[model samples]
Target: MRNITVEEFRASCAAAQQLEIVERKGMGHPDSICDAVMDNISVRLSEEYLQEFGEILHHNIDKCLLVAGEVTGIFGGGMVTHPMLLVIGDRATFSAEGKDIDVNSIAVDTAGRWFDENLRFVEPEFLDYQVELKPGSAELTDIFRRKEKMLGSNDTSAAVGYAPLSFTEKMVLDTEKYLNSPDFKEKYPESGEDIKVMGVRKDSDLDLTVAMPVVDRFLDSEEHYFRVKEDLTDAINTFIADYVEENKVSMDVTFSLNNLDMPGRGMNGIYTTVTGTSAEDADCGQVGRGNRVNGIIPLNRPVSSEAAAGKNPVSHVGKIYNALSHRIADRIYTAVPDVEEAYVWLLSDIGAPIDRPKVAAAQIIMKKGSVESVQDEVTEVIDRELENIGEFTMELARGMVPLY
Candidate 1:
C-alpha cells in the first residue's frame, strides 16, 4: 500500500486564460551538453559496475560545470583562443578490494564521445585539452558509504511532474526536436545543433523565438547565414501551419530568430558561435540548468527545482520520482477522460525504499462537474502507478526513459 492523496483543483495548467510561455534548451546548449555528459557518465559507470560487481554501485555524478571558451570568428572561418573547461564533480564508490575504478578516464571519455556524436562544429580533440574531473568530498562519500544497500536513496528530495501538455508546450518541444532531427540536419547541413525554442501563447496568437547556431565551415558569407535562417524559418512556419490545421486549433503564429541584432551589424549581431554553441564565446553552462525531466520549461506550470540528470537510477528519488511523477500524471490524465490536467508531486526520504515514497500526491483539475464522478477512477490510476515505481530503475537503465 502507498500513502497517496488525491484532490480536485479549479486552477490547472490547461485552464489558464492568461498568456503562457514554454522553453526548450536543445541538445547542443551548453547546459544541455553538461546534462548529457553527466547522464552519460552515470550510464557508463553503471555499465562498468554491473559488469564487475553484478550490480550497479552507489554513485551520483549530477554536478558538473562548463566554462565558456573564448573565440573569434567570421562568416567563413573562426579560431578558438581558449578551450571550454568541463569539470565533472560528484560522489562515487570507485574503490573495492584492491581494484580502483578510473572514474576520471570514464568521465572524460564519455564527454568526448557525446560531443563527437552531438556537436557538429566542435571537434573531440577540443575536449581532450579542456575537460577535468574532481571527485566528491570525503564527507559526501562517507554518507554514500553508510547506505545499507545499492538501491536505497541517499538523499531526501521532492520531484514534481505534470501531464497532458498544453498546446504551446507540445509545440515548443517538438519544434526543437524537429530542427535537430537527422532529416533537418540533412537539409540544413550548415545549421548547428545548439538551438533554443521559446513559445508564447496569448489567446489565439502563438509567437516563437528561436536561437540557432550556424556552422562557419558551411557558411561563406553573412548573406548565406541569412538565407539559411530564412529557409529554416520557412520550414518551421510550414510545420506549424500544418500542425494547426491538423489539430484544428486556431492561432496566429509568428517566428523571430536570434533577436539580438544591431542596426549596422546584421548577421554578426545575431546568435552565431564558432562551436555552434554560445559556450564558445558568450555563455557558460552547468548541470541542472537546462530542461526539466519532461523536457519543456513551462513558466506557467508547477515544476520541481530538483535536477534529475546524472542521479542514480536505482534509488535517487530526485531522479526516479521526477520521471515517475511525470509518468503518473500522464497515466492519470490518459486513463481518466474527466481529468483536464493532472499534477503529481512525490516526496522521498533518504534511506527509504525507492518504490514507497514518503508522500504521493496528485492534484487534478477535471472537466466541469466531472471531478466527483471520476475521483475513484483517478485514485485507482494513481495507486496502480505508485505500485509500479520499482520498475523505473530498469526502464531508466535500459534507456527507455529520459531525465531531461
Candidate 2:
C-alpha cells in the first residue's frame, strides 16, 4: 500500500482576485520549439526502447538549445544566410548487449520531422546539416545502472499543480489554442504558429497582448503586413467578445498585437520573420524556458519550477509528479461542486517508489463553507490517483498527454 496524504487549507482563488496575469507561449515560440523537439525525440526514443528492450531505458534529453540563424527578407521572400543550429544534449542508453541504437539518427530525424510538420515556413532540408547530438556524461549515465525494471525516482524534487482555472487563465489558454487551431490557420494563412498570449486583469477589465509571427512569404509588401495584422486583431477581439458574453462575465476587454512596432515603420516592424519564427534571425531558445506543465504562467499563483519535458517518464518525479499533481487537482475540483479552486503539491525522494510520495498536500478554497464536508472525498481521489501513477509512463510514451 502507498502512503500518501492530502490536506485542505484556506487560500483565495484567482478568480476572486482583483488583478491577475497569465502567459502562454504557443508551439512555434523558440523555447516552445525546443521543448517540442526534445519531447518528440524523447517519445520516439521511448517507443524504440520499449520495442527492443521491453521497457524504456534511462534517458533525459531535456537540455536542448536552439541557436538563431541569420536571415534577411523583404515582404515577399527571404533567404537563410546562416542555418539555425540545434544541439541535443543529455544522457541516454544508446547500446545494450553489444547491439547499438543510433541515437543521433533518431534525434536528427525527429527534429526534421517535427519542424516540417509543426512550422509552416521551416523546411526539413534547412536543418539537416545544422542539428548535432552530444553524448551523455559518464557520471550521469551511471545513474541508470542501478535500476533496470521497476524504475526509482531519478531526483528528489517537488511538483505543484492547480485546477479550476480562473477566467483570465482560461482566456489566456484559449486564445493561444484558437490562434493555433486549424480553422484560424486556414483563415489567416499569413499567421505563424510562434504565438504568445499575455493576459492582464485589472478590476473588471481584461487586456490581452498577442504576439504572432508573420511569414515573409505570405506578405507582399508593408500594406499587406498591416492588413494581416488588422485581420488577426479583429478575429481575436471578436472571439474575446463572444467568450465574455457567453460566460456572462461583466468585464471590459481589449486586445493588442505586437506593440513593439516602430513609430515610422508601422506594422512592418512588428514580429515578422523569415521562417515564420523569431528563431530565424533574432532569438535563441532552450528547453524549459517557456510555459509550465499546465501550459500557462500565472505570475501571481503558486507554481513549480520543474521542467517536465524530455525527462524519463518511468521514474523522473519531476515529470510524473507534475502530471499526477495536475490530474489529481483536476479530478478533485470536478468531483467537488463547491470547490472554487484546488491546488496539489507532491514531493519525492530520490530512489524511492514513485507511488509512495514523501508528501502529498492539497489546498482548496471553498466557494462557501469549510473543507470538512468534502475532505474525505478529496482524499479518496488523491489516493486513487497515486495508486495508478504507474500507468502514466505508457500514457506518456503513447503521447496521450503533454509534459509541458
Candidate 3:
C-alpha cells in the first residue's frame, strides 16, 4: 500500500459501462395489439376476478390470448419512452377496477426477465408493444369483438400448432438456452471449419446431417441461437458475393445432405414433387418432377397452375423446400435429431413481393434421443422433404391445398 502511486491506482479503477436502449416497434395489426393486451391482463387479472366471482370469464379471457397470435403486420411504435425500466419477462403489471396491482412480485413461474441478450427466437415483432389503455375501453367484450373482426374468425383453435418450431415455441422452452450456450455453439458452429468432432459410430443406422456455413474457426454457445443463425447467413452471403465467380455457376449455396438407415422401411419412399412451366414450353414432360432432382424421387407431381400450366411441380418443390428445409434443419438439428416422432413439420405460405420469395415457414421437431435414433437422421429427412417446396407452391398458385 505504501508503494502504491497515482498512476497505479488509476489503472486499477474499474471502467464505466454504457447503458443500452433496446428499442422495439409495435405490431400494427389490431389482432396483435389485442393479443398483447390480453396476455398482459391474463396473469394480472385472472385470480383477482376469480376471487370476486366463483370463476373468472375464462372462455372470453382465453379468446383474447388466441387472437393475439393471428396478427401478422407490425409498424414502429415510436421510441421506447422509458429506457431504464425493467419489465419482468412472463408476469406483467396491469390495472384492474382503477387500481394497479403487483400480484406476486416473486412469481417464479411467470415473472423475472428472460435473461437472453438476443430475443429474436420470440420474433419480438409479434410480442413487443407500447400500449396505453384507453379510458373506459379495457372491457373483455370489446377485445373479443375487435379480435373477431380483425382475425376473421372466432374459431382459432384449429390455427394453433399446425406447423413446427415456431418462434414462440423456441421462447417458452429450454431450446433457447441450449442455442445460446457457448458449448452448443462451440460444438455446432455455423461454419463447418473448426468443427467439434463427435466420434461417429459405423454401426449407427441414422441419416444425421448438419448444414450451414463453416467458419474458419469455432465458437460456442456464448450467444443466442437466432443471433448465430442471422450472423451465419450474413457471412455466407458475403462469401458468395466475393468468392463465387460469374457464369461458371454462381450458385447460391445452401447445404442439404440425405442418408437412409432403414432404406427399405418405406419411410424413405416419401418424396417431394414440383410443378412448373417453362416460359417457352406449353407442354413439357417434366410436369411433376423438377429438373434438379436429388435423392430418389424423380417423378413430378402435376399441379396445373399459372406457374406450371405445362411445367413440373416436383422439381419446383425440390429446389425450394430442399433449400428451405436444409436451412431450417440447421436451426434445431443439434437439439432434436430424431424429428419424425418429435412431430417434425414445415409450413410454407406465400407473402408479398412475389418476385423475391420469402420463407413463410421453416420448422422441425426435436425430442429426447433415447426414444429415437441420431438427431441428425430426422434432420436429414426434413431437409430431403424441403427439396420439394415447388409442389406446394404450384398448388398455392392454383388455390389448392398442397399438403396437410
Candidate 4:
C-alpha cells in the first residue's frame, strides 16, 4: 500500500511570516560551476547510452570538485598564473555486451562545452579536468537488468517542495538572473557572472545585497573601477525599482552591489577577477553546494537535501524525488482552491518501485479553507503525480526537466 498523508499547517507560511531570508548562487559561482558541469556530463552520458544501447544505463556522476588556481592582475590587464582544476568523478556503465563507451571523452567534452556556453571569459583551456567515473558495482548494476520497465528506487531519501513563492523569494531569484542577463552584460561588460544575492525581508519590505565581481580586463584604474561599480549599482537599483513598480512585485525593495569595496585599498578592497568567476583564483566549488531544484534557497521552508544535478534520472531517489516533489507542490497549489501554500514531501525506500514512494505527504497552509475541505483534491493530485512519475523520469532522461 502507498503511504499518503495530508494535514493542516497551523503556523504561517514563509510568505505570511514577517521575516524571511532567501539566497541564490549565480551560475558563475564555483559551486554552481561544479554542479552545472557534472550535470552536463550526466546528461551527455545518458544521451550517448540511449543512442548506443536501447535503454538508459545505470550511472550517477554527481561527484565533482573545483580547486582554485592562482591569478594576479592590475587594472586593464590580468593573467592566470595557473589554470583551475576540475575533478569530476562517480560511477557509470563503462562496458556492456563487450562494447566500451568512452566516458572520459564524453565527460571532458561536455565539461568543456558547458564552460564555453556559460562563462564568457573562462575558456576550456583555462581549466584542467580529471574524470574519475568508474563502472558501478555488481549489485547496483543488476538493478537495471530487471524484467520490468520501471526501475526500483536506488536509495532511501526524503525531499520537500513548497509552492507560491513569496515576493522576497521571487526578488532574490529574479535579481540574480537579471544581473546575469545578456543585456545587463552588454551594457556593463565589467560585471562578472560570479554573483550571489541575499535578500532579507521584513514584513512588506525587502533589502537585497548582491556581490558581483568585476572583470579585471575591463577596469583601467581604481577610479575607473569605482565608476563602473557605481554605474552598475545605479543600473541594477533602477531596474529593480522599475521592475517592482511595473510588475507589482513587492514593496520597498532595495539593491546594493559590492558593499565590500574600500576606496584606496588597491586590489585588496575590490572584488575583481581575471575571469568572470572566482574559480580562477580565490574559491573552489563542489556539487550540491549551489541551488536546490527550484533554484532559490528559501531558508524558511523545508527543502531537499539531495543534490539533484548529475544523479541518474531513472532510479536515484535523491534526484527524482527532489524534482517531483516540487512539481506535485506546484500542481496542488494551482489545482486546489483557497490554498495559501502547499508543501509536498516524498520519501523513498530502497528497492521500492520508483513510481510508488514510501510516504507521500502534504502539509497545507490554507488561505480561506480548512485542510479537511481541500483534503480530497490534494490527495488526488499527489496520487496522480506519483502514478505519472515514470513520464517525469523520461522527461529527466531527455534533459527536458531542469535539475539545477
State the lDDT of candidate 4 residue by residue for 1-404, as single tens digits: 46789998778988779899999999899998888888788888889888898788899999999999989877887998899999989899988877899999989988999999988988667899887888898777888988576899889999998898887888889899989999998888889999999999989888999999999999878888999888988888898888788767548888777889998999889989989999998899999988888888888988889999999999998999999999999999999999989888999999889888888999999988689988989999999998888889879877788776
Cand. 3 Cα-lDDT? 0.25
TM-score of each: 0.92, 0.94, 0.22, 0.98
lDDT of each: 0.79, 0.82, 0.25, 0.88
lDDT of 1 by residue, 1-404 (tens): 77888887657456266699899999889899888889988888888877777666677888888888888886677878888888888766677556688888888888888888888778764553343445555654454455454345667888888988888888899889998999999998777788999998888788999988777767776676777778877888898888888778777878887677543475466556777888887888899999998888889887888888887777677888889899989999888886788888989887677667888888888776666687788778878876676576868765568876
Shift of residue 150 alpha carbon in model 4, Å: 1.2
lDDT of 3 by residue, 1-404 (tens): 01100100111101111111111111211222222233333433445544543222222221221112221111111122221111212212244446554433422122122212222122223233222222222342233233221211111110001123221121112222332346645654432211111111122111112232222113222233234455644543443344334323323333212121223332122110110001011111112222111111111111111111111111222222433333333433444444321222222222211112222222332233342344334444344433444344334223232110
Runs in model 1 deviating more than 4 A are 128-150
Q: Pairing residues by index, what is the TM-score of model 4? A: 0.98
Ranking by TM-score: 4, 2, 1, 3
For residue 404, what is the lDDT in candidate 2?
55
Better of 1 and 4 by lDDT: 4
Off by over 4 Å in 3: 1-112, 115-129, 135-178, 181-404
Residue-pair clashes per candidate? 0, 0, 47, 0
TM-score: the better of candidates 3 and 4? 4
lDDT of 1 at 195: 94
Q: In model 4, which regions exceed 4 Å deviation?
A: none
Clashing pairs in 1: none
Candidate that beats the other on lDDT, 2 or 4, i.e. the better one? 4
> Which candidate should be chosen as best, given TM-score against the real structure?
4
